[model samples]
Target: MVHTFSGNPLDREDAGRRDDVWIDTARDDDSTRFLALADLNVPIEGESLHWLHREHFDESDLESALLLGSEEGAARFVVDLSNESASADRYVDARSAATFLSMEDAGVVAHARSLVDWHRRNRFCGRCASPLIPKRGGNVLQCGQCEANLFPRTDPVAIMVIVDGDRCLLGQSSGRMARSNFYSALAGFIDQGESIEEAVRREVMEEGGVRVGDVRYHSSQPWPFPSSLMIGCHGLAETTEISIDEKEMNDVRWFSREEVLAALAEESDVLRIPGRMAIAHHLIHDWATGTIEV
Candidate 1:
């Protein structure tokens, strides 16, 4: 299955990056659909997520807008709201919006969230401390003094299902909130100069004292909570002695296949994995159902 934000709904035309006139024209076009965000809060209406039409909202209410590209002859653009008090438009974070919106809309909204969030954080250049200006339709930021270019960033995370025979290892991160006996897959950010497979092996050993061998790539998901690319994989555990790092996880344990099945079926008294909204859920489910090669 295509993960929530893995599939994009718009065609991010690369060739149009140099067309300043086209970008400006598309932003003001009547067929343009705008997604306005403020402090990472997205606009919503009733049960549906709607985008602002170009002619509806005042131009003054927009802070920084980007050309998102066309679909079926209609242009889609994402904009940052000038202020919180500008309009009474209902707003919610990406998590809440994902629950009610379709996968395509969720993906589009996530893209918008990452873009607006990048612009909000990268207001100045690190080289010369000069204010960065939006270029290439907010896809790139340029420094006036140094002429340095900045692009949106995405952190890559290795989220894996470590299987040891009939059971799989799962843990709750030390930073995660209390989840009433819930344990998801172990994940860590990919380190510099390390391949994703190497990062997975290293993290498993560092966290739980387990040796991972034979890693298999499964799927990837775009986790838009501040922009993350989740690389989901399955790993066979060569040794499974439980010696967990307290600083890495609040709890770490092994659950049997039957236990995982019960949890996925919502009939477990011990384990409660993440819901379908997360890639971890899919990873766990695939392992539990014998779909993933161990």
Candidate 2:
């Protein structure tokens, strides 16, 4: 199941190092290797930043390079001189790159991108009005004043595929692209003091106006668009009637397994389900394949 999606597994041996690692974005040295995310259709160049593993290369083995960030608050990742043979001139967005890279490679890149984005956004200390510095090999942020340490945060979100018998509940968000009738599971952020089960029930009720029972955790994924951990679940539908919150969703409906498979295979730009890169797609696929029983 994990291997079905992109950015699932990463070789963490090098990233597990406890030393403060550097990401070089400069072009002068030719010894470093760079993975071009833009080639895969990610909209921004180096917009996502998070480190997965660190490799110990001698300072002399690699040349010092500058990290470049976008004017709109993008961080500069490591520069690779070894990628000189590759076309560095081309810039592919991260979204497209996720499709291009092998699932393992995409996962690594997503981790690094998420970490870097965290560092950039959390530049100031929350406890004190002091500037924070990177520590713990870029994993921890320390405030110069008061000596406070901060860690990266992954927001927990609950996403569920609600099932009754031969049908599952799906909703279309109001913010969806034009001409899109595609729907997946209902999802929402988990509020504080709410258990995952509670979240599943609450989100289902709030978004689709349906009561859910027997909520069970199915799988989880690190969604690093801006640091989110998607908690996937399967919820037994206690009520089939759906009353969607018009402000949040455009429409809600129940889909049969056959209908879902059709949507999954649908290639039209208009009638498409979530991409395979997303856990939503996995949840649907799993349900369709009987891997996740309601």
Error in Å for residue 111 of model 1: 0.2
Per-residue lDDT of model 2, residues 12-32, tens digit only = 323322333433322222333
Candidate 1 residue lDDT tens string, 1-294: 798776677888666756888777777778778877767777778755677787656665433577666678777888777464534357888888888877878888888888888888898999999999988877899999999999889999999989999999999878755446889999999999999999999999888889999998899999888999999999999998988898878878899999999999999999899999899999999989987657
Considering summed lDDT, which 10 consecutive residues are worst modelled in model 1?
80-89
Clashing pairs in 1: none
Candidate 2: list runs displaced more than 4 Å.
Answer: 3-87, 267-271
- How much RMSD separates candidate 2 from the native structure? 7.7
Q: Which ten residues in a row have the lowest lDDT in candidate 2?
A: 65-74
